[model samples]
Target: MDGVKKISLVIPCYNEEKNITRTLDGILEVFKSSSILAKYDFEVIAVDDGSKDATWAQIVEYAKKDNHIHGVRLMGNFGQSCGYQAGFDASTGEYVITVSADLEIPLENLAKVVELLEQGYDFVNTNRKNRWGGEKKAKSGMANKIISRVSGVCMQDRGSGMKGFSRVLVDNLKFYGDMHRFIPDYLTVYRAKMTEFDVEFKDRDFGVSAYKGSQVFWFYRSSYYRLWFLGNCVSYCAKTVGVQYWG
Candidate 1:
């Protein structure tokens, strides 16, 4: 353990009872096989976003079996970003990353993410070339493009959930509402040493997508987030550069 580093995996699961165990095993398969990754001791923080199913029970069971596993149960159904907020607050690792319990992105892709992080990138966000379902791809695509244009961040897949952050970034950033999706834009303001990596997209094997009908105002929502990002930047600059007394 002397040479090992602690890494935390924050997973936000909602009604993913059927996919809980598989998600854990998939992660195990990645680190178990790699000699480099073997030195990175991993802990799983599975946040139950008030799942109506037995997802919380499954998390509790897994935590009992593995000392590295933990379960966080929210009072009610908060959004995904809120779930991540809970997990982030509870995480105790030098490096933190997130993946869905439904296995949307291949767990194996995490190895590369770990490598990038170890190389000293404060933030690494993935660009998924192919997504599972693009039912609302047109609107989603427009949103991504708009964000990239306004934020001065060239991100192809801004909404890709495959992201990793150094503990320093985790402590400084807070997730709320759907702000997690705009992490890349905020990174520009934070001036974090960041990288963009490509990862393959995989479809979930169990349960349906929770975001099925949430894209009606996708354009409008992204506009609001864009404004939010601008507002935050103005506020951060003011706090840092204003009211300095020159003697």
Candidate 2:
């Protein structure tokens, strides 16, 4: 491999047949124009989480044409965490990233993530640069702030979908239920090195968003304390139980 690192982007799709191919092309274009990211090879792992549409068929067609593309299909609707788990299980790269299949966040901002990883950060996250001035956006923003404060993982956007993780971090972490939404907070349990930045958000031109807006926060609100407690336990055990140290 000539010492070159590989980055795998994991995108979870739920009825995103219209957007999947375009999303992959956008990432490829961003990589080609990026001098910083050119040194590394990249692969895409697209998981079709029981889409009623032809999402899986689109993934299969693209994969046949591009060797870097890998597709996995679930027998039934299993939510985002499970979709991500499927992708993670199939990934074979030094760095793994989770991105929205609808391209809500610009793919070009990926250069920032690669730079941060190269500089020694084990995880990287990005928040939208501007607020869209809507009731739902305001509500989700407020809700995320509360969620982050309660978990002591306060970043600008804890629920941000696009994030990067080192292979080491990915190996040590697992997602269950809708816990993927709280990855940054949970990473604190493993004591992973992390960083965050702002990436411009774009209006979707394809079908409407798959997410349920601010209501999406409801999936993990009850689990916030559970995660907080788990993080504390890890820290406590590190001092007394001589537990495995992730840092």
Candidate 3:
């Protein structure tokens, strides 16, 4: 170990009261058994995105027990982008990782991302293998296919909950509505060195997905958020290419 490699992990929670404690325990267990722990120091920044449940209470409880854990409670549900932004802004590490509070992606898989980061990759993306089964898989498959076709990005799962990147990549990111879901695309536009790997998956143990059909329908009904996402992408591309394209 050349030096202590500091890593900051940020997780966004919304109504994940049932799973947050287990998720945090799993992460700490992973770190305890990890071969890289001797070289790495870690902190967990969990942002409660105004969950309507006991999510914030759980976060505060865990933070009190562990100094390495920090909790941020938002005044209202400002969406995942805002939650991620809060965590990102609070992060102070050479490498930062993002994961969902659902704990769908197994904790041990994070070591591979750390290895890739140490190998000089700016961003390490992951695909959750065997994420769903039967009908759910069928639905996700169709939806993902449509999303890929529309986005023109061929990542098997671009919206995977786990991601690892260096501080430099975080500096380049500007999180907005649904922008976290398109992180790989954004990093590609910036020409950041990247790689992808598969990770173990588990079904979400508690709480329903925040984005239900009715909620999604209503979200798209108001074109403001959609436009905000598109505008950011256009602005990024224009700035990177040094062109005035968004006018």
Candidate 4:
């Protein structure tokens, strides 16, 4: 908070036409109203992961109006990891933040993540408060809980899409396949400082979820997701070892 710093928000979108406008509005409103804006300049980089709908159109239109709002359109649906990688590669901020495109996680919590980073935490993650709202939600939470317990990271919400980290942390990150799910654990492997804050979660009222069930479920459904489940397992095991050694 000494000098004016920049915060780059990387949002990955895939056919989120119904929610994209709200997502953009939410972030812009934060910058306009939050006290953080007094000390930090912010940019929202939305990556359109080959959205079949009008998601890209919205991004383009918004970007033209506000130079701080940027857009990255992938050649094809490269999954969230690739989308994030694209945004990260293009980001020019000292602190980088990533969130879901669904707008399920309120945009207001983003200011808290940046606040923690300012307090010297290298990585800040969030936990879903209303996690018991649905069976699928419960199952996903259970899966992530198992992963966190087995990996020994203990954040309990490794899969949370809302996260904040420094540029150094982002540079050290290696994203591939569906490895974004274990982001908190990956930061642990790199010996980065991490903390978590609680935030309310909501169900998507617009678009459908891309990953419905098991990892392998997508392989049979689309070629873009083939072997993603296997890749996820490999990344999980490899990063877990790294955590055990460094942590």
Model 4 global lDDT (CA atoms, 0 to 1): 0.74
Q: Per-residue lDDT for 144 in model 3?
A: 52
lDDT of 3 at 176: 68
My TM-score estimates for the predictions, one after another, are 0.87, 0.87, 0.81, 0.82
| RMSD per model, one decimal | 7.8, 6.6, 7.4, 7.9
Q: Candidate 3 versus the native: TM-score?
A: 0.81
* Model 1 per-residue lDDT tens digits across residues 26-118: 777777887767788888888888789998888888788877788888778878777777788778888999888888788878888888999
* Pairs that clash in candidate 3: none
Can you write out model 2's per-residue Cα lDDT over 1-247, one digit (the tens) per residue?
6688999999988999889989988887887898987888988899888889988888888888888788888777888877877788778899998888988898888888888988899999998866456776776677677677876776777666689999987776667665677777778887788889988887777788756555755644545666655544333311111111100
Task: Indicate the residue-level lDDT of 216 in model 3.
Answer: 36
lDDT tens digits, residue span 1-247, model 3? 3477789999988889899999999888888898875368889999887789998888888888887788877777778877777787778889999987888888888888899999999988888788666665655555555545554556666668888989987765767667665666556566778888988877787877765333433332433234334435645521111111000
Q: Give all candidates' CA lDDT scores.
A: 0.76, 0.77, 0.74, 0.74
Tell me model 2's lDDT, rounded to 2 decimals. Answer: 0.77
Please list all clashing residue pairs in model 2, or write none if there are none: none
Assess the local accuracy of residue 63 in candidate 2 as a C-alpha lDDT between 0 and 100: 84
Cα-lDDT of candidate 3:
0.74
- Identify the runs in model 4 with alpha carbons over 4 angstroms from their true place: 1-3, 134-138, 212-247
TM-score of 1: 0.87
What's the alpha carbon RMSD for model 4? Answer: 7.9
Judged by lDDT relative to the true structure, which candidate is superior, 1 or 3?
1
Pick out the ten consecutive residues of candidate 4 with the lowest summed lDDT: 238-247
Pick the winner on TM-score between candidates 1 and 2: 2
Q: Kindly list the per-residue Cα lDDT of model 4 for residues 51-91, writing each as its tens digit.
A: 89999889888988988889888878877787877788778
